[model samples]
Target: MQLKKLILLVTVLAGSYTLMAQTDKNSIDDKQNESQKKIKKSKTQLKDAEANFLLNYYEQDGDHSPVTGGRGTEKLENVAPTFVVHIPLDTVSNLDLNFGIDFYTSASTNNIDYFEGRKTGASGKDVRSHINAAYSRDLRNSGNAYSLMAGFSAEFDVTSFNFGGSYTINSKDKNRSLSLDALYMNDSWKLLYPYERRSDGTNWLKDDKRTTMKFGLSYSQVINKRLQALFSAEVVSQTGLLSTPFHRVFFDDVNGIPYDNLRSFSHVEMLDDNRLKIPVSMRLNYYLNDFMRLRTFYRFYTDSWGITAHTASIELPIQITPSLIASPFFRYHTQTSADYFYEFGQVSKAMVDAKETQFYTSDYDLSDLSSTKIGLGLQYSPLLGVGRFKSPFVKNKQVQFKSIGLRTAFYDRSDGLNAWLVSLDFAFTF
Candidate 1:
């Protein structure tokens, strides 16, 4: 009896010790997991509020001004300034604000009073202003995110309002992502007709409002450690006043022609009331070395107006130093003419009067053309930023001058149009 009791006691003690050991192991594992999660959260949280300022100067010159019936100078200059800000609402949410203004002068628009031989004044210059706001949030630990946006823009001739939303899903490993977005825009025009055609006492347009809808889907993937790619597709639909009220179209027939010293016959541009467009694009990036990267892009576009376009571009970004980068890029684009697009004096007035066609336009933008753009961009950003200053709005805080960027480009079109653009950008963190 004594031997049996001793054996039972030993067995019970061993079993109890084993159970205690397992419980301690589980507790340690739970604490370790909780600590790791905290570390990750801390690393992912936003640390500062960011802001950017941008300034741009653009100028263009070309022939074939639609305002002058596609046979005059098309010279324009513009200065634009934009500001952007991003604020962290929480660990997983952010708010973004963007505002911009554009000041422009156009010789083509000045021609509105050319027929009357009046001096171009306010008709040649205009200002446009725009503002946009967005809010975005991420679903914690779910790899899902969403954003909502609203914007408005106004100018002397038109006002536009837009609203949009986007949803994104990322893979658990963060190597792949898919995004979907949709937007709607409404534009209202003042119907500013040309100087010579204003008193014709005719209702030239059916509606002064235009509506546009866009939907897009994009997918990005990390093919390998050295390569990444993105594919995107979009569908766009537009309705209402699709033609410019002030653009003039000339015809070949008698009523559209001229006698000795007579002015060429012209009418307002016309187009379909509704249109549809589809575009697909792809971007590929390859890490060539520690100091250089290659980025390539291609796009195919088609529309219901009998137009098709293709675009291809390549860029090489070189790391000049730890804090500096330089990128040189080239782009080429080609497009077929729209079905209703006619050059200067290509369409006959009698054919239109006889109802041979329902739509016609002399706008060079709708004509078959090819274009090339080449540019270089430089950026400089230091490890701790270029400098720091005390925050004006927040006490006991500092703002850092994060980076500066400069970009310049030259663009040329197959049809006698050429343009130059230069822009500067500055970034700050508070």
Candidate 2:
């Protein structure tokens, strides 16, 4: 009887152990299924993608053409079209692509090949295209974001490639933020000289490479519900050819006789190849009411070439209706001339003869000047889609128009330069 009791006790203990093992296994399976469901839900919450298109037309007319020793028509026209797309990779990452093309015609550029000593400016046209791609990701619930970008630009005589990255950190409350960015660019140029400076077949510029580096830091804060502000500072360094090859600089001889009939014959521009630049800026936005806002900006800039500049701008935006907004803006900018800048007929005969002046530029662009720009813009964005179109190649795929904007600006410079620009922008989503 004692032996039977012992066998029964062993069987009961073994059965209890097996049942506990099965329960633990089932618990693990349930935990894994719940974790997978959470992950799927997070992925499905990704945001929708968007796209934008912009077109601009600009025209300018002035009498100071640098290529002609700063004494001819500076007429130019430009048309630029740009496209941008934003795509969400997942719940915490996104990708952006941007492409743009600019077609321009400049009367000043035509002066590089002045015709038979004639004063008539040449008509020069060229095209420039650029593309940029970027990827950005948000840290896992940390309110930190990081981005990397690469870009390339190409033109008839110039090509440049750039790479950059930025990081942003936000406060726990999300009302304050800081950002840092760095960029590097490599540029190659095909040197083309003024008609008079080029010997029968010899090139003027032997070295045509340039490199640039930039660093930036910024901070943004919200002081109150109606006021927000941001501050930014940047440093830029550049090395190699900074002067335009075709810009003509005329000099007077001891006899006061201008070289080459003061028309076609002259020396090209020369300047320091290395430069450093620093700029600091601030922006403030004030929300006056549900329908009105004010934006203001100011910047201070200084450079190694002895140039100092200041810029100030203000804009007021008013919501005319639920679907319409109007904004008017004004900007003022002033800058001191570079140490080497010389206006037309301003260079002395002694300086020309000594040839000791290490730096000299007859380019008016480097001269002291003040400018003002006034602009007006209108934007239309309805709560409901304004229009939609189905893609012929993709079934059940449609694109909707979200908003449209138009802007026009008039620019005037103290140095007799003036311009007008009009731009149109459209936003869409799929």
Please tell me which predicted candidate would have the highest lDDT against the true structure: 1
- lDDT (CA) per prediction: 0.73, 0.70
In model 1, what is the error at residue 331, expressed in angstroms? 0.3
How far residue 259's Cα lies from its native spot in candidate 2, in Å, is 8.8
Candidate 1 lDDT for residue 399:
94
RMSD values, in order shown: 19.9, 21.1
Give per-residue CA lDDT, model 1, range 1-430, as digits (tens).
1111111111111001100100010010000000001123475666678897878787778888777777777787778787878889888888888788778778887876566765343337778787778888888879799888877777777787777788999999999999988777788888877766777767788899978787889899999999999998888888998888888877776344442222335578889989898888899999899888898998888889998888888988888887888888888888899999888878877788899998998777778988888888888877767799999999999998888888888888898888887888888889
Question: Which pairs clash (backbone N, Cα, C closer than 3 Å) in model 2?
Answer: none
Judged by TM-score, which candidate is best?
A: 1
